[model samples]
Target: MATPVLDKVEAESAASPYITVTMRIRRFNPEVSDAVVWEDFQIEIDPKERVLDALHKIKWDVDGTLTFRRSCAHGICGSDAMRINGKNRLACKTLIKDINPEKPITVEAIKGLTVLKDLVVDMEPFFQAYRDVMPFLVTKGNEPTRERLQTAEDRERFDDTTKCILCAACTSSCPVFWNDGQYFGPAAIVNAHRFIFDSRDEAGEQRLEILNDKDGVWRCRTTFNCTDACPRGIEVTKAIQEVKRALITRRF
Candidate 1:
């Protein structure tokens, strides 16, 4: 009788009891350090563990002071969005197996925002810009007696922007936002596009005027970083381009 061959999973399970991963987390204490610093933590994590899980372990078992925000661990909350290995991603969604296992993963707060603690950043400005766009259905008359009826085609028009989770991932990854904090950023523009292009919205012209400013959608260079970093797979650049097209067409 021949011996049974073990698969990769079985081999890994038999060979190693646990996998050790080094996480180089960015540390900054506003009261203690004049600048940001890097702190490394070696964690014996399971192969199936996620980056967020490792972070939680470090916070719970290793360091009680390590800070990061998380609401839903399934990537829907978007509160745990950060820069991992210089790329924007949701910590809950990234798996240890997908990255360079041998090398240390660098985790930092999202760029273009004020870091409150280890991986937590203040997102007030990001939300303010979102509010500035007035991201809601504004009907001229009283509320409809029933739910606003619309065809599938109408819903599909703004479907791309509807995927946003208000994570600030798109806005933080934007270069224009980095240089100019006043810029509305990708997330805000994405939300504006949602209402502006909606068939049911009656504020297209007014919203377009708001986005016509220098720091509005005009600042977007179509870099596509926002789309790449988006966890929800939204077409951020496409929506920004559509808004630009509307602005130009309406002028003539």
Candidate 2:
């Protein structure tokens, strides 16, 4: 006969939702091989755990060589953005149970950027596009008298785009970005929208001129993929459209 404690432990174990999930990751290492390969990792984890937790297990216990980027696992850092099961998302923000662990979860580096390793990509190009948009407050005067001021109405105009963390999820999901790397992707336009609509920003016209270039805001296809891929719940495509409208009408 089993003891009471043993019976209770057995019952709890039986009710546990732990499952063996297969993570199919697309790997690439120019130093190791020129060809990209898909590697599968079978991990035993709780259904409610995060995908990042599975990756941690794989790296800690299964294979130390499994590479990926993550910081501030709470998702604020935006360093862990990647494609999971055909959709771009932050690995730390994605839950295993929500993504259906029964089937293999496919993970890969975000598209458009050149992959440096298993899941890391070269972000210099993305940052270059961001810098090209002049994503900053450009006031035409000396130091502000007492910090630029704005009314609630003015702040609300560009509040939606201010939540961007520069994860590159929206940019990599863009079809236009994938086809033509030169196209200023949705992330850049979204950042531009934040400052372009600001009542205190004086360089809105200059920024608009930069976006009016051939590979700028006009390249957006409005497929809404960037909006869907944003982990911050930002209406990304909407911001891009606002930028386009501002360029055409010269009104923020």
Candidate 3:
């Protein structure tokens, strides 16, 4: 006969269950071959665990060679951005339970960037375009010892674009960026927008001039891909539109 303590232990164990998750990642290694390959990993994990955790288990326990980037796993660093289930997202921000575990979760490097290894990509070109836009405050004259004061309305003007963490999630998701590597991507334009509306920044016109080039805001077709792919909830398409309007109306 089963004792009462043994029956209670069995009941408690039955209350907790873990789901089997399958991750199919697209891998590339220049040292090995030009051809890409799909690798599958199966692990038992809690439904609420993040995709980054799954990748860690595979790298730590299954294969030490598997590669990816991650920092500040809570998702502020944006280091773990990748294509998950046909969409660009931060792996650290994506929860396994949010996406169905019944289907295999597909992970790949963000598009439009050259894959350097299994999940790492060549961010040089991405950063190169970023540098072209001058993503910084440009104020002339002597620096003020006191804080530059602005009205609350002025601060709110460009606050939406300020949430970007330079993750490249929006840029890589853009169809325009995928086709032309030279185009200044949405991330660049969004950064420009952040400073363009500032009441104190004196270089708004200069940044607008740089973006007025043929490869600038006009290239954006308003596909809404960048807006959807941004992990920080920034209104990317609206900011790009505002930049376009600023050119015509010359108003912030």
Candidate 4:
């Protein structure tokens, strides 16, 4: 009986595929040092596992000092947004095999913000930009007794932008954001577009006014980095262009 159980466990272990890879993460702690350090971790992982899973193994099996943020682990929470292979991505959404595993996988905190610790940056600036755009629905008159009706076309108008989960992946990837901290990056513009195009929202012009500033949509250079980095596949650059055209034409 013991031999049979041992054989079964060995068979399962052999059936599972795994590879050894190096995970290089950037470490920054103000309390520790003013300079940044890169920490390397080697772990065995399945090809199907996500980058977030690798982080978990390193934190659990190797180093207890590693720190990061994650929730829901399915890319919806956006808490695990980081720079993977020198690009902004949600750890849960990026598979380890998709990136070149032959080389050390470089995982670092997103740029253009103060790093509170390893892998987590100050999200206050990101959220403040979001709040500035007034992401919620703004309407006039009394509340309707029933749910507000919307045509299929109206819903489709802003549907792409609505997929945003406030992940900050799109914003952190923009080069303009890396240079100018004042620019309300792609994430903010994408959220503004959500309400700006909604047929029922009456505050479109007001939001547009808020965006028509020196640090607004004009700052975007159409680098296409934001579009490439968006985990939700939101046409961020296109949305920014629409906002720019709206500012020019004064049309919602």
Model 3, 1-252: lDDT tens per residue? 999999999997787667899999998888889999999999988888899999998999998988899989888998999999999999999999998989999999999998999889989888887788788778889988999889999999999988999999999999988997777999999999999998889888988998998989999989999999999999999999999999989854
TM-score against truth, every candidate: 0.94, 0.93, 0.93, 0.93
Stretches of candidate 1 above 4 Å error?
1-17
Candidate whose TM-score is highest: 1
Clashing pairs in 1: none
Model 3 has an lDDT value of 0.91
- Against the reference, the lDDT scores of all candidates come to 0.90, 0.92, 0.91, 0.93
List the RMSD of every prediction in angstroms: 2.1, 3.6, 3.9, 4.0
Candidate 1, residues 1-252, lDDT tens digits: the string is: 434555655776787667889999999877787688999999998757789999999999999989999999999988999999998999999998887768999999999999988888999999999999999988788788998888999999999899899999889999989996999999999999999988888998888999999899888888999999898999899999999999999999
- The per-candidate count of clashes, in order, stands at 0, 0, 0, 0
Please give, for residues 129-152, the per-residue lDDT of candidate 2 as tens digits: 999989888888688668788899
- Give the Å shift of residue 134 in candidate 4: 0.7
Error of 1 at 144 (Å): 2.3
